[model samples]
Target: MASHVGERMSGSIGVNILLYSFYALSYAIPGGIILIHSLGGGLLDMMFSMPMSRMQESEADYIGLMLMAEACYDPREAVGFWQRMEAAARRQGEEVPELMSTHPSNQHRIEKIQSWLPHALEKFQTSDCQGTSAFADAFRRALERGTQFQTIYM
Candidate 1:
């Protein structure tokens, strides 16, 4: 479990870095275009960019969920993760309208995940691995423990 989790976490870190880099580059391209052309870039530019940013975020979520599913982690957990993130954001007083935010709203994320879950579950089910490894079992136990802890404390 430790090894699997470690590998997944490491891979996730790399993937996230790559995704964010792409997102930054995407923004930079438009900003550069606006600056070079003197397109009167301002709130309007930002407003136009918002949809692209949200799309990037949504793409990242979809890819991440698929990666997790491929790694044998239940993709359903993604919904809980987003819910917790939303709760945390609320606690931090960072609530923002979905249209203005770079990322989709948590409700939207959860709904998106739910929409994709059947495909994720099919991937999990069709995987050749016949049985759970001890590592997977331990990982699941740890995840459950973490969920319980969050429920009790958060």
Candidate 2:
């Protein structure tokens, strides 16, 4: 909802606006500068962090597959979910969500997901069929938040 204060303060307001104009400007200008700085700073951080984050995401996906399998859901859903995510990304054009973007694009990730399938299947079978913790167990635990991974394929 666009309230009166928000509407009046948002656009380019003149000096004769109100007594609070100075206060608003004082707050707004620095806030705007800070916002801009924060973005640039975030980009700088991503320059170093993106590669590590990508690795983390891949690790997460691998573990997430194990968790899904252990929970009796097919691990193959990772591929489909990633595909849909890539499609959604394409539809979004240049305005991708920043906070949601902590790793490589779905296009780059799909192949990795495909390659890891065989191992994941093996792990699942060994774990589920044998009743042992299996090799994927440690990874599953390490990727504690794997439950939230959006798989590339269903």
Candidate 3:
């Protein structure tokens, strides 16, 4: 959320500068040329901004997973949640190319979570959650079972 806010603030500043520039140039440039420039600028902004937005989203996801594991909660549940989200999207026939979207696709998120699970699991194991809950037991079992790509449906 902080990243999003920062991005929005920066984007707003950029737009303001563009708006001021457009106002100054309006008297010198033809209206048709100004319109074309505005459209092209908007397209370029979107092309740059979409990937940054997706990166922010992925960063948030990674932070959330780490925080959850640090809190001794199961990071594997993150994968399951995203899996369900992917399933829901599929059911709705909703698909967007990653480049055009503001967020990473669910499958992409799942893959990243899987890749980071070993670190998160290590954090979970070292945290004060030992013998604290059923989730702890499952974590142990998963470690014993080899942690990668294992989904824990909640």
The best candidate by TM-score is: 3
- lDDT of model number 2: 0.61
Q: TM-score order of candidates, best first?
A: 3, 1, 2
Off by over 4 Å in 1: 1-40, 129-132, 138-154
Q: Which 10 consecutive positions of candidate 2 have the poorest summed lDDT?
A: 11-20
lDDT of 3 by residue, 9-121 (tens): 88767766765676667667668557847675666556666777888888899899989998878899999999999999999989787777889999999999999999999
C-alpha RMSD of each candidate structure in angstroms: 11.8, 15.9, 8.2
Candidate 1 residues 1-154, lDDT tens each?
Answer: 1243454455456545654555555566756544534532334334554565676677778888887787777888899999999999899999898886767899899999999999888887666544555677888999999999999999
Leading candidate by lDDT: 3
Candidate 3: global Cα-lDDT? 0.81
Error of 3 at 34 (Å): 6.7
Q: Residue 36 in candidate 2 has what lDDT?
A: 46
RMSD over all Cα atoms, model 3:
8.2
CA lDDT of each prediction against the hidden true structure: 0.72, 0.61, 0.81
Task: Order the numbered candidates by lDDT, best leading.
Answer: 3, 1, 2
Q: Which is better, 1 or 2, measured by lDDT?
A: 1
Candidate 2 wrong stretches, greater than 4 Å: 1-43, 94-101, 127-154
lDDT of 2 at 144: 62
